[model samples]
Target: MKLLLLTALTMAAFAANSVLNRAAVGEAGMDALAFGVIRLASGAAALAVIVAWQRRGFAMGGVGRFVAVAGLLAYIFGFSVAYRGLDAGLGALLLFGVVQVTMFGGAVMAREAVPLARWVGAAVALAGLVWLLWPRGAVKMPVGGAVAMCIAGLGWGVYSLQGRLESDATQATAMNFMLAAPVAAVVWFLWGAEGAVTGVGLALAVVSGVITSGLGYALWYAILPTLGAARAGVAQLSVPVIAMAGGMVFLGEPVTGRFVGAAVLVIAGVLISMLGAQVWAGRVGFTKSSSGS
Candidate 1:
């Protein structure tokens, strides 16, 4: 029960990233690179305080640290770049599709046993995503935006997998922010001035950093041990749905029929992929034991 709650909260946090990013960059006319740098810098500062209070020193000792840093860079850059051309909902769907593919592919590469049910679920979800985002009559896509969304998906998938390899979530998250901050700053220095950076932009970055990205991620790390990979992935699939709903309610974005259908498919697919195997294994064990008894 605790794990379920934690996972749900984590998904909400992740979902907010999309909504907030859209609001900041799309509505406010803020530069994406500036937002990314400010968001990450604020998060890094906040985490630094927390880690210092806890007496944790920075450490990047092994391959995990390298992977974490790389994942962070990809996620930050991919996120900022993707929004340049993609609409919020469409971007979310695209990113989710890429994320699902990346993580599942990672699992296969790691030689983790794949169940047939999961494969089917993945296919179902991918098909749903395609339906939701594919350009229809009159809805021509910005190719650059689509490309950015795919990159973001790949980056986030790597980040999620890297979290599993970290010995300490808080520590790793803090270090990643600290390490990535410099990179973000450099990128911003190169490109930030091109876009007018307003008070609204900085405020959005701060809010995202302090609330959604920083503390949210720390909490996610804390719960990862309890939830494991399958449950975690399934839980994250809720994020895009939540973000879409939030957009409708708060941002006044139009809710469409296709989005609803896509949400249903993604949610159902995630549940099947994550929970089916465990339930099947449990039933099999129970039957064998009962027959022996």
Candidate 2:
């Protein structure tokens, strides 16, 4: 139960990230590069405070940390810059699609066994995404932004996989954020000056870092051990749907029939992917005894 709640919260965090980033870049007119840097700095600051207050042990040199940091840099920069031409909903859909596909493909390449249900789930989710964001009636997408978002998604997928190798989620995440912040800052210095960060943009970026990306990531790392990749991926399928809904409510973006349908399919895919474990647990004698007594 605790793990499930954390999983839900983690998904909400991801959803909040999409919504908040959109607000900053789309609504506030902040350059993606500047917003990305500010977001990273804000998240690092928030995590640093938590680490200090908690006195968490953080030793900073390892290959895993380096990989994670690089991946984080790619994701942060790619994510921010990608939005220069991509719409929020479409960008998110493309991002997650690449993330999921790459991660799943990586697992396959590693000789990991994937169950039939998971494949079905992946298919359903992919099809749903296509339906939701394939540009209706000759609406042209910005090719450069689309490519950037795909690369960003791949970076994020690699990051997620790297997270699986760490022993301490909080320690690893803090280190990644702290180290990656400098790299992000450098990129910002080189590119961010072009777009001045407005007040609203700063606030949105900070909120994204402090609340959704920072603490949310801490919560995610805490839950990763218990949830594993399949469950984690399943839970994250909720993010795009939530972001679409948030876009409707907060940004006054219209929700189409295709979006609704995609939501259903993606959610169904998640449930199906987890069905085996859920069913097996239910069938185990311990579940009944524990519940009854």
Candidate 3:
């Protein structure tokens, strides 16, 4: 129950990130590169404070530190830039779908014994994403935006995989954000920070960085031990649905039948992926115990 609560909170934070980014970049006229840089810097500061409060000194070197930092930068910059041309809903669908696929592939490469049910669940979730995001009419999507979102998803997947190897969630996340902030700053300078930025946009970015991203990532790392790669990937399918619902509530977007249907399918897929393996394993153990007895 505790784990479930923590996971739910982490997913909510992830969903809130989409809303905040949309508000900052789309509504408040903030430059995507600037927003990304601010978010990384603010997140680093927030995590640093938390680490200081906890008396944990900075320790950044590890087995996958380089990969983690690179992945973090890719996700931050790609996500910010991709949203410039991509619809929020469509962008989220693409990002989550790619993240799931990347993580599943990584799990296979790492020789994790993923069961068949999880694979089917992933397919069902992808189908649901397609159903939700497929254009109904003559909507044209920018190829560059799609590619950027895909890269963002891939980066997030790799970051999540690296998190699974960390012993200290808060410390690791703090170090990653700290290291990535300077890189993001450099990218923002090179990427042309020439867009309008209001106070509201900066506030939104700060909230997203300090709360949704920093603390959210810490919670995610804490929960990763309980959820393996496939389950973790499937579980994140809820983020898009939550983000859509948040849009309806906060952004005044209308909820349609397609969204309702897709949300059901996605939720069902996550449940099946997470629980089916456990149930099957439990029954197998029971049968063996009975036979031995």
Candidate 4:
């Protein structure tokens, strides 16, 4: 139950990132690049403070650190830029769909021994995502935006994979943010200045970085060991549903039948994917006991 609560909170935090980004960039007229850089910097500062408070000197030394940094930058930049042209709903769908595919593929490659039921559930959830986000009438996609979101998704997938292997979630995340901050700063100097940042936008970006992103990512890493890759991939499908609900509340967006149906499907899929593993484990244990008896 504790784990479940933590997972739910983590998903909410992830969803909040989408909401905060949209609020900052879309409504506040913040530059996408500036928002990304500010977010990264603020997240770095927040994590650094936490790490210091914990008396943990930054010691996140691993071969995966560089890869994680690269993936993190890719996700931040691509996500911000993609939102410039893509609707938030459509962007979330595309981003998470690619993330699902990437993580699932990685899980298989790592020989994680995922169950059939999990795969089926993932498919169901993905189908629901498509149904909810699919544009009506002739679809006109911004090519650059689509490609950018795909890159963002792929980056996030890789970053999540790296996080699963971390021995110290906070320390590792803090170190990554610290290292990535410099890169983000360079990007900001080069391109991010194009977008103006209002006081409201900066505050939103800081909140997003510190609360939703920094602390949220640490919590996610802490839980990743319990979830494993396959289930984690499917579990994140809930983000879009949460984001849509957030939009309605925070952005005054309308709720639609399609979203309602998709939310049900997404929840059902996540439940099946997570519970199927327990059932499978139980069945295996029962088989062993029966044979011994």
**Winner by lDDT:** 4
If ranked by lDDT, best first, what sequence of candidates would result? 4, 3, 2, 1
lDDT of each: 0.75, 0.76, 0.84, 0.86
Order of all candidates by TM-score, from best down to worst?
4, 3, 2, 1
Residue 157 CA error for candidate 4 (Å)? 0.3
What is the per-residue lDDT of model 2 for residues 1-293, given as tens digits with 9 covering 90 to 100?
56666777788788888888778877888777887788888888888887877888777857878888888888887887787777765787788888887777766665555666667776776677667666656665699998989989888888877776777777777888889888888867776377868999999999988889888887777776555565566567678787878889999989788878888987777766656545544676445311110
The collision pairs in model 2 are: none
TM-score per candidate, in order? 0.86, 0.88, 0.92, 0.93
Worst 10 residues of 2 by lDDT: 284-293
- After TM-score superposition, the amount by which residue 276's alpha carbon in candidate 3 deviates from its true location, in angstroms, is 1.5
lDDT of 4 by residue, 237-263 (tens): 988889889999999999889889998
Error of 3 at 204 (Å): 0.8
TM-score of 1: 0.86
Model 4 clash pairs?
A: none
| Predicted structure 4: lDDT | 0.86
Q: Look at candidate 2 and tell me the lDDT of residue 199.
A: 96
